[model samples]
Target: MKHRKLISLAIVPILVATFIATTATLSLAGSSINPRLYGSDRYETSTAIANQFSNQTVSNVVLASGNDFPDALSASVLAHELSAPILLVDRNTQTSKAALDYIQAHLRPQGTVYITGGTSVIGSNFESLLSNQGHQIKRLGGSDLYDTNELIVNELNSTSDTVYIASGQNFPDALAISSFASQTNSPILLTQTNGLPKGAQEYLTNNEPKNIYIAGGTAVVSGSVENEIKSISPNSKITRFAGQTRFDTASLAYSQLAANPKTIYIASGLNYPDALSGTILAALNGDPILLIDPSTPLVPDSIAMYLAQLYKNGATPNVTALGGSVVVPDEVINNVVNLLNGQSQSPLFNITTVDSRLNFGGLPVNLLPNKTIGSTLTLTNTTIPIAVFIRR
Candidate 1:
């Protein structure tokens, strides 16, 4: 339940949406969806957030992006918004400049910068960026010097009093960490358990622990997990961060974080297709309840809320890109073809693709929408039209 007085929406998320299969002829050409034109009301940095939004306590903030770097401003703003420690996921030299730039822009000279991640892969100077930003930075383990497994184990082992959990995207490494934590018998516990699990679903009811851990705000702690929170942990703290990658990976991360009285789940991969959504991030109020970039906000609008509402209402978004292969599936192709099967000809269906992705430079096929075959028309050899990234 969010603020009903301030934010109003037909609020929905398209994560589990079942895209309708349409034939080219049946698609009903010229149909369009109402696109929302909105952005942030104000610009902000990562000053103090996540906490205000979380129903729990979180220790660190994790930055997970599939590409080069999360928008420096966005990450920096988020760190400031959460006011928790920060973790940069793209730990590599390729990311050095972006990381450094992030620090220079966000960190104050007196701040302490902590160097973590594979050292050899990401330069030692990475930590310096934070240190120079006025924050005190302490260098943690490095990947360049050791294996992430070893580093993760060593770090958790060294800090026996604290427990660390991995959340977000279904990364193999993140999943392994969850299994390892459950197997370990140390007092320093890294938690791993989903509220949505068949077993835990029953346990969480009135099982009333002081807190609950969420893997990522967007992934695991959603769907049935939402129901669990509604039934059990409504008052339970939601310690979530941006870290995990896929839906399952995030579930594991939230699993680990839930171990504590106050859990902190992290989102892993920010770049995965459909990994996020615009409508999902907008309801970005913290447990503390603050919306800095209310309009052009970063994270998807209340991913959890949207998921819950969409599921409840039986509505979803028009997202076809996440399943992979932007080439337009043969099913869709057939739909278009079949639609035109009965008719002699069908109007050309327009395709809008970004420029960089189109490779028409060396296309050998003809660049036409549908072809003319006898009395019936057909569409084939799309090497040209698929070259959306290429210019004519």
Candidate 2:
């Protein structure tokens, strides 16, 4: 009995090793990439993102209205500065339970919660709720959305010579530069397409940032606005990042921010909530966030083209999709995987294992025959520990 047990113990490791080797070989056939989905809803997604940093103690939390984008557009930089998570709350609700719970659990004892936008946008009741919990609350709202953005920038007390200007009328331009802005500790100021907002004008006139980067094309941010910015900060070096579409604009922004990233994040371009919270997480890793049209089944052309060049240069970035399938569907993610594999369609197909009795490390494993295994196999929780072989 002792001899038999020793032989079984030896065999188990060999089987495990063999299984891992086989699967590793199959995984290497294509880019070892997969999309990790964050949450089921926007509110839940923010908590999920916050949980990513659970290992560390968060000192502050930024609360913004999920109903609008303008107030939260400039919150990323502030969140990065505070080493906090940007949590989205419903303006109608007195409090967001998920956000509150996360704050209670992670925030330091004396930590303060920052609220963007006025009481009209987030309400006095929400502030009262946090104050009741013995948490210090600081409101950074102004007379208007632009003012709120400027207030957030002022709160940063950033002396960095670089600043970013995006269209306040839309979310794409602002969201595109969010991660980069947060990473660099640069304030992202919002402006109108034809004219600069008073808040932004005052900031430019006073600070005169040496480097100004304008996101979006001339149509989104008119030449007049650019010239106005130049005139306000004449000594500042100005650069504009624009593309044919919002998706293209995101690609261009990311390409300029990171040369060869090992990880890339995707969020729906149609909405701002996912990207808003996601920017903090991406910024923490110095990664870029690419916007995708969730309505489309395939990846955006510009994103695909940009990723293709990265793959050509031997980059296999791990792609993560923020939000649920409703916002960023499985089809779009599959297309990205296929693109990385240099295939127009999925190279995966169901393959029946020839040996069902195979076991590795006392766990059941499905062993594929050498002749039938494909180039890649996507495994889920229910179907892992699979070993594939190529028929010689």
Best by TM-score: 2
Instruction: Give all candidates' CA lDDT scores.
Output: 0.29, 0.76
Per-candidate clash tally: 93, 1
Error of 1 at 49 (Å): 12
lDDT of 1 by residue, 1-392 (tens): 32111111112211111212222322322223221211121001111122122324343333323232212112222233334333333455354343344445554455545343434434555555454445664444423222322333333322122222232223322322332223221111122234333323333452444444443444433445445555755665544444444433333343343222111111213232111111012222110111111111122223333223333443322221111213222222322222222222222222222211322334332323332212232324432222111111
* Model 1: how far residue 375 lies from native, Å: 20
Which stretch of 10 consecutive residues in model 2 shows the poorest summed lDDT?
2-11
lDDT tens readout by residue for model 2, 149-250: 988999996878899999888999889889888888999989988999988899899899988999999998999999999889999999899999998888
Give the residue spans of candidate 1 off by over 4 A.
Answer: 1-82, 85-95, 128-135, 142-350, 354-392
* Candidate 2 TM-score, C-alpha based: 0.78
